[model samples]
Target: MRDITMYQSNGENELFVEQSVAQLPQLSGDTVTATIEIDAGQTYQEIDGFGASFTDSAAYLIHQVLDGEQRTELMSKLFDPQDGIGLSFLRNPMGASDYARTVYSYNDLPENGTDPELSGFSIAHDEADIIPLLQQALKLNPEIKLMASPWSAPGWMKTSGSMLTGQLKPEHYQVYADYFVRYIQAFAAHGLPTYAVTAQNEPLYEPQHYPGMLMLPEEQLVFIRDYLKPSFINHGLDTRILCYDHNWDRPDYPLTVLEEAAAEVDGVAWHWYGGAPAAQSEVLAAYPGKEVHFTEGSGGEWIPPFEQAFSNVMRTGIEILRNHSKSFVLWNMALDEQNGPTVPGFGKSTCRGVVTVNQQTRELTYTLDYYALAHFSKVIRPKALRLDSAASNELVRSVAFRNPDGSVAAVLFNDGEAEETVAVKLQGEEVLTFSMAPKSAVSLKVDSK
Candidate 1:
């Protein structure tokens, strides 16, 4: 038996851990109990220490799994305070992705105008599923930052004249720019203001499956600097434009675009399917001031209880954290047990979402991804910057932050096979030291300097 205690550097407060493991041989299970001890003079991090964001994947999942009362309940869990993920950011498709039931874009009709202008364009295509879902999400967290990305432009705008192509016709440059402006304004009118928009999703790849369009680095630069930027300004839209909405494997795409266009774009977004974790480091090295966001990717197709062990969640969570990502938005928020609402001719594969909704029982199944995200979302609140921390060689990784409330918040994880001890310091003073359990994540809150 060991005694675990946490203390503040100023010697003002202390917390003690209390444990009560079952003694019965038949019912014994591995369990560690943590107890909090507070001294009279102690202060800790504020409740709004960390923030998180969510995505539009919840809508399709809700439609497929729950209906009416059931849908509302699940939505609350995603946005409501009692159980909501408390998301402050959301990612929505400009048109349709593989996650949607069908494929379509905001302006997917045949039309032509040299430097065509979208004077009468609207978002009638997304009204069915994306709109209603976004309204409910906003109702839950009005502060949520919405981001829009086009899986593919309107079919007619591409050189291939289809969603699955690698080029956008130069003839429609002005029209395409107007298309973006219309999208932002339309979504805003619906009470869901988009905070950001990416030039093109996976711009480097044109899939023959679902909706996808590839835009070259030069094309992106021209579109953003010469067309999109001017269009946004003309429309008086505040939504920021992000470039390179693709995988880490092609950091050069965003790098080249931003390096050449300079201040034309606000930031760069990356996906996780094509490259290793270290790929972001290359981009970060080149563009330090720019924001690097992990916009999409799912761990796998299932969420098992054992997967909750740090190796699966904590390990990967730390990797993303260490990569200098301001935020991490997983692919699907909610999905049916079978993992679908899949579009025809998309990818040859499917993956799991954060929450698994049982259509038959009206029961909600939260995955390791959900728990892992909660560990950060519940404690790290939005706009919180990554501070600093030190840990061992095991799978555990840690990051600290100085909260606006004059307190510090630190998240530590042990994703390896054995438990380890960690020491945390705030303002160069040792405040607390604790032995992290194997396969577990813990968040420490302490008063700021």
Candidate 2:
């Protein structure tokens, strides 16, 4: 027998609650039982990490609304491996996202302005709250990786001459690439080294209200192959380039870019808004070596009864990983009680965060999204490999992993209407029996004995 810890979320007070260590029983002879058998010999993609984005609004609420002591406490719960979920992968906006307090870019210009040389490119705006909060997160977990996405480029580089709705001007392609280089260097100066960068955020849809830019796959191919790739090489930047930072509905979008510049582009980034996770697999089928990342998905107010929503999102995370995604990332990390302190009058957001900071009571409320993310992020460590696990029942979907620390963990989310009990087998040996409530989750981890 070996000591193992079980963390469960039954949609009650037990939200990722760690139960006392229990001894796991070994399988006896001639016992034939249905079980979820973990095969460590068959390993898939290496997990980069799991986390949510730290947008401008999230940083504002975390840095401005919460005091020093409160911010430390909250960040510790978010980033500390021992004290919290230990989210290691985070995404941020290079300029501004829809969740920002205002619609602005690194280099803004007057009504009819053009900086062909991109002389005024500066990330001074992020210095105030965004950079500091990121620095604090680094202190909590040194393995943290930061990815940057641009909602839109500076107004001068776009056809509409505004961040709201525009297409990148063909003449300023190299200049825009220069913008990315400066962004990486600027953030790196603050000790926040960027791990990866996407060409644009949701390049297909041009939102009339928020900052969005329309970029076709063909255009993105040119931007990545001719400009972005060469620019990185010229500057000797090791940061990887990921294409298609949009929903799963368009797997062909990333395939188009990878078809032309497969070597130049590193991977594909996806969102859960549109189609199914199978789209990720479709891309991987064509280019088996490329990486798939679940970059952004949000649990909004539209989904009610917090517990059920958590179950759904937790299921979505598992599905994404099973589809072979290296990382699973959600939308916003924190939002104000009003759902947002959004770009006033424009891009009004109703999106919920993992945590919410009440502007009125000045208390941080940990939402169901936080707990849903905790189940996977808390147990899965960086560089962990997903082990091949067979699901014995249809109602229960699960993915098992063997972390780098020599600990084996399985995260199971029950989607059935009733309770489910399944035997857990580790490398052909029955280790434990788990009974999970419907619309609930459980994480069982066994340390090296």
Candidate 3:
């Protein structure tokens, strides 16, 4: 008997439950229904990992709000592979994103202040809350990889002299590049090395309320080709450079940057706000080896229903990976029960984090987004190759991965309005069968033995 495990999140709006299925009863005498065929022969990209960001607010909530025991419990649930979801990937704002307590940068200077030498640069701000929380997570899972991006450059670097709606001045390019080098060095010193970094976050547009910088493809080409890449090299840093941390709709943005600066950059980073997941493939067609990383996406108030959120997250998660994203990273790891502690001036909060914290009582509730992410991060290990799988049933949106240990993990979501059960045929050999509830998701893991 082969050992198989299923982690399922069902239509009842509940969390995922792990169950053991001892054996597969083979199809008897010419089965009428179709089966899902898994073939490891045809494989795809190596998975870097899956997870969400630990924004300023997320870190604050975890580090300051929770008691010591509660903190350890929560961190374990998020990072420990044996005890929790085992999220292997994560991102953090280099400075302030909209979720920060206040707008600030590592190299903040007074108004009309300019430090071209960047002598005042320090990561003391992150040292307060961000680093401690990250240290705990790494303790739980040493293999976790971190990626970082800046929402806006220091106020001194932009024309407006604040972390607001101003473009980065051309002359400060070299110093800004130096800022990135310092950030990588500082984090690594604390035992948290950054695996990748983007030039800017959502570079195409500037926000009126939050910190933002308008950097176009031309500016990025010059910045990476002339400044950023050189700074990393001169410092002897191996951290990868990713460009165009924007939406799927603007494939041209990253493609344009790659047209000239491809050598200076390792891959393209995407967001889910605008276009189609298939856009990744379009970019891949032009530049085959360059990677695609879904760096930032948020599930929020607009789609508030639990079942709806589950369907969207799993379907989109599978679709993007199928299109060849090495990693799937969402926006926030945790938030207050109010959906925020967001930028103070912003009136309405729309985003839903993977988990929610009740600052008033300090209680935590894991959201469906958490379970949706678990279906992938908990089953597929880092560097696992995506295996080819074909589904006969239309509602069966399945993506399979072959782990480095030779086990197989296939995630399936039944988009239809009713439950469906199908046999799983592995490499032309019948192995197992499982049932999926409607508008729900299931992650199936098959042992090599």
All candidates' lDDT scores?
0.65, 0.88, 0.88
Report the C-alpha lDDT of model 1 over 1-449, residue by residue, as the tens digit: 22221211110121111222223123111232221222223332122211222323456557654668877776676665336656656788877777776777766665542225554466775675668877887788675678888888787878777776657888788888888888888888888888888989888887777788878999999999999998888888878888997887877788889887767787778787777667676777787667666677676644444544324555555566667776677777776666665677655445767777765675787765666665566555665656645553535576665445545556666656676555554554545545665655666556543
Residue 312, candidate 3: Cα error in Å is 0.6
Error of 2 at 256 (Å): 1.1
Off by over 4 Å in 1: 1-57, 63-65, 80-83, 110-120, 302-313, 360-362, 392-394, 447-449
In model 1, state the lDDT of residue 395. 57
Candidate 3 structure quality by residue, lDDT tens digits, 92-188: 8999999998988999988898999889999998999899888888898988999999999999999888898898899999999999999999999
lDDT (Cα, tens digit) per residue for candidate 2, span 135-245: 999999999999999999888789988888999999999989999999999899999999999999998999888889999999999999999999999999999899999
> Model 2's lDDT to the true fold?
0.88
> Which candidate would rank higher by lDDT, 1 or 3?
3
**Model 1 lDDT-worst window of ten:** 7-16
Ranking by lDDT: 3, 2, 1
Q: Is candidate 2 or candidate 3 better by TM-score?
A: 3
